[model samples]
Target: MRLTRRGLLIGAGAGGGLLLAFRLVPRHYAGALVAGEGERIFDSFIRLARNGDVSIAVPFCEMGQGVTTLAAQIVAVEMGADWKRVGVEPAPVSPVYGDAVLAARWAPLWMPLAPSLADSPEGTLARLHAEREPFQITAEGTALAAFEAPLREAAAAVRAVLSMAAADQWGVGWETLEARDHAIFNGRQRLGFARLTQMAARFDPPDPPVLRPEPAREKPGSFPDGARPAYPRLDLPAKVDGSFVFAGDVRLPDMVFAAIAHGPQGASVLSSYDKAAAADVKGLVGVVHARRWLAAAGTTWHAADKALKAMDPRFKAAGRIADSVALETRIDTGLRKGAGQRVAAEGDPDALLAKPSLSARYDVEPALHAPLETATCTARLEEGQLEIWLATQAPDLARRAAARAAGVRLRDTVVYPLHAGGSFDARLDVRVASQAAAIAKTLNRPVQLMWSRWQESLAGYPRTPVSAQLSAAMSPDKQRLLGWRTRMALPASAIEWGTRLLDETSAQAAQDAAHGKADPLACEGALPLYAIPEKAVDHVPLDLPLPTARMRGGALGYTAFMVESFVDECAHFAGAEPLSFRVAMLSGQPRLVACLQGVARLAMWGGGADASGQGIACQRMDLAAPEGLRSGFIAVVATARQEEGAIRVDRLSAYADIGRIVNVELARQQIEGGLLFGLAQAIGGSTAYAAGLPQSARLSQLGLPLLAHCPKVDVAFADSGEQPFDPGELGMVATAPAIANALFSATGVRLRRLPLLSEGF
Candidate 1:
C-alpha cells in the first residue's frame, strides 16, 4: 500500500518487542477463553500457551518508552493474568499485529468533537473505514491510545474461555465463575491458570465473546479518584543489570564487522574508493559499494574502521551538497512567495491583521537526533530469505527496505528488533538497514554494520529546518486577542521523499505524496488553541533536497517554540501578564486553561515578590483520531536568569493533562526528559551546516544539554479523569517558548530564533 500523508500519520502514532519466550505443556482437557489451535492463532497480540504462560507480542518498537509494560498491563488487566507471569515479545512484521497508533493518526486534528474511547459504534466504524489499511509503526505517541482497546478485547476474549472452562469443570454456571489474579474462583473453590489453561486450550472460542471495560487502577495515587494501572517495568531490571540486548551488543557466529564511509552530501552516490591503500590492513575482508554509501568488512570493527579511514572514498557530486544559505532561502521563499496551503482558518484573520499587529518570525536551525547508540544493524541473506537484527522504530519499513535491497520477496524477509540505544526518529529511516542487508547479501555471510560516530552523524536524517511567522492583533482596548495568523514553511519529511525516490516511480510517489490530510507532521503545533475571533494557520511544504526526518517531537517541538514565543510577544504588546493573557484567551478550552493554571500554581507564578523572572506558555497536543479519539494537554512555566552572558534556567515547572496517566514516575520522567531536550535545543542543540555537509558531527559540537545545565523541574498532572494519552513528547512542546519568554522577561530582550541563543541573549 502507498504511504500517503494519512498513512504516514497513522503509522507514526506510538507503536515494541518482548525478549521472553513462550513454553508449552502437553495437555488438552476442554471453554469461551480457551481456543482450539486453529482459532487461537488468529490473534497475534496475546498468546496463551498450555503451560499457563500468557505472552503479549507488541508490534511497536520500544526505545525506552515502556511500551512492553503498557502492552502487558492491558493484556493482564483484561485476561486476569499475573503480571509477574506475563511474557512480552516483539511481534513479526504482519498486518495481524498492526498498531492502532495509525488509526489514531488517521483522525484529523480540526474535527469539532474529538475522538474518544467512548465513541459510539457508528463513530468508531467511521474511523475504521477512514483507515485505508492497517499497518504497523511506532511514533507520534500513539501506543496506549491505539492498542488499549484491541488488546483488552483480545485478552477479555481469552478470559471468557477460561471462565467457561471453570464452569464446566465445577458443574456450575459460567456466571458463578470469576476470573481474577490469574485464577478462576467459584465461591469456595479456585482453579489456577495452569490447570485451566489445558482445558481452555481445547475449548472452542465463542463466536462473539463478551468483553469487559477497562479495569480500575490497582491503587490510587495522590488522587484517590484517579484510576491508574500499577505495573513493574518489565524491561528495566534486565537493562539495569546489563542483560538487556541492544543491537550494538548482539552477536552472531562467524559474523563479519562492517564500517560505513558515509557521503558528506545527503545520501551522496558512491563514486570511487581507495582499495589499494586499505589492501594491506590486517583482517580486512572486503569493501562493498552500496547505494548512497560504502561499507568495509573486517574481522573486527576496529580493523574495518581503520581500513575505511585509510581508504577515503569520494562521491561523484560531493562538494557543497547542502548549503545552509540555500536551504534558508528556500524555506523563506516557501513561507512568503506562494499561496500557502491553509491548514486552518476562520473568520477574517487577514482583514483583522490589517490593523496594528504584533508580529515575530521564528527560525529553527537543523537539529540532530544525536542518539548515544549510533546506527547499528546485523543482517544475513541465506536460503533466499533475509534476516536482520537492529534497533529500529519502524520494523516493517526496515523489512520492506531489506526485501527491496536484497531483491527478495517481502514475505521472505524477517526483522528482529533489539533494544535501541536511543532513537528520536533517526532509526525510522532504513538507509542503514538496507545498506547492511545489501552488503550481507553480496558477501553471502552474516554482516554486522555499525556506523562510526561521524558517519552516523553525517548519514542519519536530522530534523527538518523550518521558518514560521506569527502575526496577531489585539482589540482596540488592548485587552483581548482579536485575530491571529501563523505561517510555517518546512520541507516534507525525508521519509516522504525517500518513499517516492527509491524503487518506486516518481509518478507513483507523487500519487502517494498527495495532500488533503490533517496538517503534515512537519508542522504539528503551528495551530494554536487560544480562542481568537479571527485566526489563520498555514503550513507551506517546501521541496528541498535536504534529508529531513522526525527528531524527538517532530514539528511540534519547533512549532510550539514559534507559536508560544510569539504569543508571549503579543502578550507583551497587549500590556498584560503572560499567564493572565493566556488564561484570558482560553475561553472555550477549559482543559488547556486548567493546564495553564496548574503550571502557574506549581511554579508559584506571580506570587514571589522577588525580582527573579519566570515565563509561562501553554499548548494542547492532539493525538485524537481524525474525528477526535484521544487527546493531551500541556503547559509550562520556566524560570531562568542570565548569568555571565549565558542563559541559566534555574527552575522549570510543567502541568499536563494526558487523560489518566499509567505510571506517574514514568510520565514525570518523560516530561523531564522532554523539557531538558527542549532546553538543549533552545540553548545549544543544533546541527551546523557548511559547504554541503553537517559540520557538527561530534557530541561536543552538537552542544547537548549537560546535567548541570538542566533546571529544577516541577511537574503537575491535571486531574482530568480522562482516558490516557501519549505523554512521550508533551513536555517538550512548551519548553523552548517558555525559556525564550522567560529570557525576555528577565532582560527585556526579544529573541525569535532557535538554538535560541544564536540570535543573541
Candidate 2:
C-alpha cells in the first residue's frame, strides 16, 4: 500500500476524507533497491488529503532555509491548490526517497580527477545508483534540485487524474478541463476538487502521465508562469507566533526529561554511576545507562539536570583530549605524515616551482555550530512500536541508529523530524537519537533526552581544522602564472564513521576515504581558478582526536580563503591590479569571470579604493540545480577599516549566479545570512579543548560576532534567467578570503591564518 500518484485514483476514505501517500523504493539496503526500466511504480514524496490540506512529507530537514515553503509551493503550483491550506510533515524513512542524484553528484565532485561516468546527468545517476550506495540524509544543498522534478511530476499526475474525472463528469474533452484554485473548470461549469475526488478515485490513471508544458522564461527574480508563489515561508508564521514545535517542544503523556553526560572521548561503556547521590534529588527518576553514555531522566528538566551532575560513570577506553595548541599540533603532525592523494593535477608543478616562487601557508581553527538549541531527542515505546522525535538533519539515519541502539526492529520504529534551532552540520550525527531511544526502551516510558550547551560543546563534532601549504611560480616576465602546487591536511572527519552510521553529509567523504582518496568536499576550491600552465593539489587526511564534520561551506570556505588570498599576493607581486589580474586569468572560465565582474561592479572594486581598504575574492560554490545538475557560482568583495586599533568590516557586497533564482528575496537572505556567519568565524573565534573537555563551551567564550559588529551586506544576483540553480551556502564561500585580502590591503601584513586578528596591523 505504497503512496503514489497512481494511488490517488484509489480515492479518499468514506466521509469525504482524501489521502494519498507517496512511497519511495522499498529496500533492505540502500543500493539494493533499483527501479527496473519501464517500471511504473515511483517513490512517494508527498501526500494530499481532503479538508483542503496538503501535507508535504519533506525528505530534507529544514534548518531555517524556507525549504518547506519552497517545496510546498511546487506542489501547490502543479496541483493548482491554494497555498493557504498546506502543511508539512517529515517524510517517513524509506529507500524509495533516497538521494540518488545527490549521491551521484557527490561521487564526481569528490573524485574530480577521475573519469566521469557518462556525459548525461541521467546516465550518471543510473551508474552511481547501480554501483555505489545512495545517501538519504540532507546536506550539500541538494534539496531543491533533487525534489523539484519528481514533486512537480507527482503533482501534475494527480492534477491530470482530477482533470480526467472532471472531463468524464461533464462529457467534455479532458484537455478542456482546467484545474485552478482547488477546483476544475470546464467551459460550462466548475467542480470543486472535493466532489471530483470521489469520481477521480474510480478511474485508473494513464500508464504514462501527460505532464504540462514547461513555463516560459521570465526575469531572474520573477516567478514565471506556473511557478510556485513565493509566499512568506510557511514555517515562519508559527515560528514568529511561538506556536512552532521544535524538538525541544515535543512532549508526551508521562513524559520525563533527561540530561546526558559523557565519560570520556571514545568511551563505550557505562561502568557505574553514583546512584546514592542522585537518589536524594527530588523528581529524579533514575540513571539510564547505555554502552557509551549515561542519562538521567526526571519529572522536570531542572531535576534531571541536577541529578545528572551528581553522578559519575567510568569508561573502558578513555579518549584523548588536547588543548587548542595540542590539537593544532596533532593536525600539523598528521599533515606532515604523507603527501596523501592528488585530487587535481595538470602539467608538472614541481619542475616549475624549482624556480623562485611565491609561497604561503594558511590555517583555520576548528569552529562550532553553536546553535541556540542543543541536541534534543524524544523516544517512546508504545504498543510494541518505538516512536522517535527530534530536530535532526537526517531522519532516516536517526531512525536506523535508534532501532539498533534500542534493540527495536527497523520497521517498528517511526521517526518524526521537527524544526531545528540550527544545524550547520552538527545534527547530521544520530548519536543523540540512539541515546534517547536506549533510555526510553530501558525505562519503558516516554523519554525526552537533551544535551546541555556545555555537553554539546564538549561532545558535538565541529568543523575540522585545516592547514595548507601553497606555492605559485610566475613566468620570467612575471606577467603570467607558470605553476601552482598546494598541499593541504584535513581530517576525513565524519566520513570515517563507517557504514553503521552513514549520513548524506559525509557519505561521499567516507567513500573517498575508503579507497585512499581525499574527500573532494574537504578540498574543494583548493585548486587555483587562474589559468596556470602547471597546477597540482594533494591532501593529507588527518584523523584528529576530536570528532569532525562539515560546518556550513565546509572545504569551500577554507580553501577559497587560501587560494584567493594567494591570488591577491600574486597580483601585488606582478604589479597588477587585483581585480584585473584575476579577470585576466579567468578567461578560461567565462561564467566565473562574469560572476567576478558582477561582484566588482557592485562593490566598486579598484575604484581608487576607499581609505577603508576593499578586497575581492571569487569561487565556485557547490549547488545542485533542481534539474539534478551540480553547477553554481558566487563571488564576494569585503571592505575593512581600522577603528581604534581594531579591524571592522565596513561593508560586504556579494554577487551570485545560481543559474536561476527561486524566491529572489529568500536567495538574497540566504546569501546575506551566510556572509554574516562567515564573518563571525573570520573575526576571531575558535572552539578550544582542554583537560579532556571543551574550554569554550558558553556563548561568551565562543566570541560570536555581535549584531553591532555586523556591517551592511549588499547582495546582487546575476540576471541568469528562469533555470534556478543551487541557492544556499554560496554566500560564505568567498567571504573569508575577501576579508583576508581586504586586511592585507589595509595593513601590509600577510595574514595566512583564521580568526583574523588586528594584531598584525
Candidate 3:
C-alpha cells in the first residue's frame, strides 16, 4: 500500500531519519484473513486503494454491527471511487489503533468517547474552550455525542481541495468553481471526481492541502428531507460466490478437521476425562486435555464431529456465576465501600425521585449473537511458524492473543478475516481464536475448529443481562421533566459474559454506583429528543459477568425500549397524543423534531390503526458521528391486530437520515432486515435465563419471526442524505419501544416487559 506524500509526513514513525516509507510503514493490518496491517498504517491505505476499484480496511470486527460495510462506504465516498470497486476487509486492532478511526469515520461530526478530565468547574471551563479538546474529558451529553460542525467542516475541506485543484487545472478562480451534485463546475463544462483527482495528484501537494473553508458546504451525494439515492457496498459478491474463503472454509493438504468446545461459555473447565472414548474412536489422534488443546481427525466435517463426540471430554465449572439479583446486592455493598470515579452528579435526582414521580424497572435477558457461523478458526503449523485463517473483526487482536497461546512470534502468524454471516459483538478476536491457535500448535497440523451449535450457544459470549430502573419527576404541567434517576447492571467485562447479575464484585460495584439515577442506556434519546432544560441524567453500571460485547444495538436499543415507552406514558398521562407531546418537547433538537415530524407525517401519527396505524419513534444517535454512517433513522411501523388480538406489523415505513447512502439496495436491506431483526427482538429474539443457564437453545424455542409472522416492511430514503448512518443498528433501537408504544394504544395494557406473551400484554 503506497501512502500519499502528505500522509507520510503526518505518520512519521519513531525516528526522523527514518522516512517511514509508506510501504514499509505497514498501514495494512494482517489477520487470518489479511495480515500485514499494523493498525494505523493499514487504515491510511484505504484512501490509496482507489484506482478504478474501491478498497478500504476496517478494524471493528463485523460482529454483525455492519461496521465493515459502513467503513467501506465512508472511505469510498471520500476517495471518489465507484461503488462497484470498493473492497471491505477487516483490519487488525493494534493497541495503537484504539476506537479513533471508527470515531473519525462515523462520528466525525461528534466528539470522541472520552472520560472527564475536569474534576472541578474550572477545569471544565478550560476544556470546553480548548483549541483541541482536552483528553479524558467527559461531556454532559451522550457517551459519544458532539456537534456536527466538524464533520460538515471535513466534507467542506475535501470539496475545497478538489475545487482548488480544479481551479489550478482550469486556470479559474477558486471561488469561480463550486462542487455540485458530485461534480465541480465553473460554467462551460463539468469535471467529476475522476478528473479532479488526476489533476490534484499531478500538482505538488498543498503543504497544508487547500482545505474547505468553515462556511464551505458540499453535499457529496445530495439527499435531504427523507430521500436518497443508494450507493454501492464494497465487493459483497466475494462472500455470495464463495470466491472468498473463511476460517471454517479453509482447506489444506494433510489438514484435519475438528469440532471443539471452550470451557463452557464463561466458566473455566477445572478438569476433563476423555481417555476411554478417545481410545474407542477410530482415527482419534489422542486427546489433549490441557487448559487449551486441539483434537484432530481424518476426513469430513462429520469426522470432526464424531471424533469430538467420541472423545467425550467432561469438565467441572471453575468459574462462578453472576445474575441480576446478586448484582444488585453487590452494588449496594460497593456503593457503601465507595469505589470508582463519580461519572455524573446532576440536579438533585435524589430529591426528585423521593418526590411524587413515576418509577419503572426494566430487565433484559441474556442474548447470544447466534451467528450462522460461530467463531471458527483454522490453523496449520508450518516449519517453525503457523499459518491461520478465520473470520475476525480484529486480526491483530487474533495475532497477539494467538501468539500468546501458541508461544510464537507475531510475524510468524498469519490471520485471515472472512465475510461474516453474523457477529453480535461476541466475535471480537478473543478465546475462539486463541483456541484455534493453541489447537494448531498442539496438534502440529493444519486444524480447523468450529464451535458446535450447542458450543456456539453455551460457550459464546452474550449480550449483558441488563436491568434498568428509572424514576422520573414531572412538573405540575406534566410536560417538562423535573428530574430523572437511573440504575443499570453492567456486564463483567466488555467481552466477558456474565452468567448472572449482581453476583460478582465489580458488577455489584457498578450497580451500587448507579443504584439510583438516570441511566444512559435506558434514557438516552428518550430524554431530550423533545427538550427538558432542568432535567438531569445519571447511571449506575453494575459490573457482572455478563458479556459486555457488542450487540446489534447495545445501549441504544436496550435503553430506548425503556425511555421511549416511558415518554409515551407521560404523554398518555397528559391526555395528549405522543407525537404532539414530543413535538412540544422539541427545543434544542430541530433535526430531531423535524425527523419526528417527517416520520409522523408518513406514519399518520395520532391516527388510529385497528391494526391500521401506529405512532412512531425517532433518534439521530449516529448523527453524533462522522458523515455517511448508516444509523441515523426515523421509524414508523403500522401495526394491526388479527382476530386473536395479536399485533401483526402490516407495513413498516421509515425515513433514514444516513448522510450519504451507499448500495441503496443494501441500505434498504439493512432497514428491512433490521425490521425483521427488531421484529424478532420484539416477538422472537428473546431468551429467558434461569439459574444461570439459558432456557431456549433451538430456533423453535427461540421464536424467530418467520415469513408467516413478518409482513411487508417498506423503507424509504431521504434524497438529500449525505451521511452514511448505519442501518443495521438503527433498525433495532426504536423498534420494540415503538411496537410496545403502539400496542399500548391498541390494547390498554402498557406492556412494560419484553417478549410480549399472551398473558403479559
The all-Cα superposition gives candidate 3 an RMSD in Å to the true structure of 7.9
lDDT of 1 by residue, 1-761 (tens): 11111111111112222111111122111110223342232244666655677778777888887878877887887777788889788877654444444544533321214544423222443234222122466777877766676677567667776887898989887756778878889987999877776566445455444566555343124633223436768888898999999897878988999998876644357888898999999999988986567788999999999998889888765333676878888888887884577766767688877754677788998888888888899998999999999988777777887888888998798889876877876776666678889989888889999988887777766677888888888878888888888888776553353343232323224324533222455566676777788887887777655666567777777888888888887777877777778888787788888888888778888831124468888778766542255678888888888888788999989888888766665676688778887788888767766655788889898767678877887877876567787788888878988888888878877788888777766
**Candidate 3 lDDT, 1-761, residue by residue in tens:** 13233332222232211112222233322211221222112223343222323345454445434445655554444433355655665543332223322323222113214323321222322223221221111111111222222222223344555677788878887657766555678897677765564444333333333433322122423533245445533345665776755557678888777777444333445365555665555656534445633354545657666767766665555454534455455545543342333233444556666764687766555566677777778777777686667776545556666777788887787676665666654465356667777777777777777777766766655555555556677888876666665554443232122111111222224333433432333334433344544444444444454334446676665777777777777777667777767767776655566666667666655553334347466665643232222246465555644337456766665666654554556566667676677766766555544344456756576766668877766566665444345566777777777777777666666676665552343
How much is the lDDT of residue 160 in candidate 2? 77
Clashes of each: 28, 10, 106
For each candidate, the alpha-carbon lDDT, in order, equals: 0.71, 0.71, 0.52
Candidate 2 error regions (>4 Å):
1-43, 106-134, 215-230, 264-273, 312-319, 334-337, 497-500, 503-517, 607-611, 622-628, 758-761
Candidate 1 residue spans exceeding 4 A from truth = 1-42, 100-134, 205-207, 216-229, 318-320, 333-339, 494-521, 607-611, 626-628
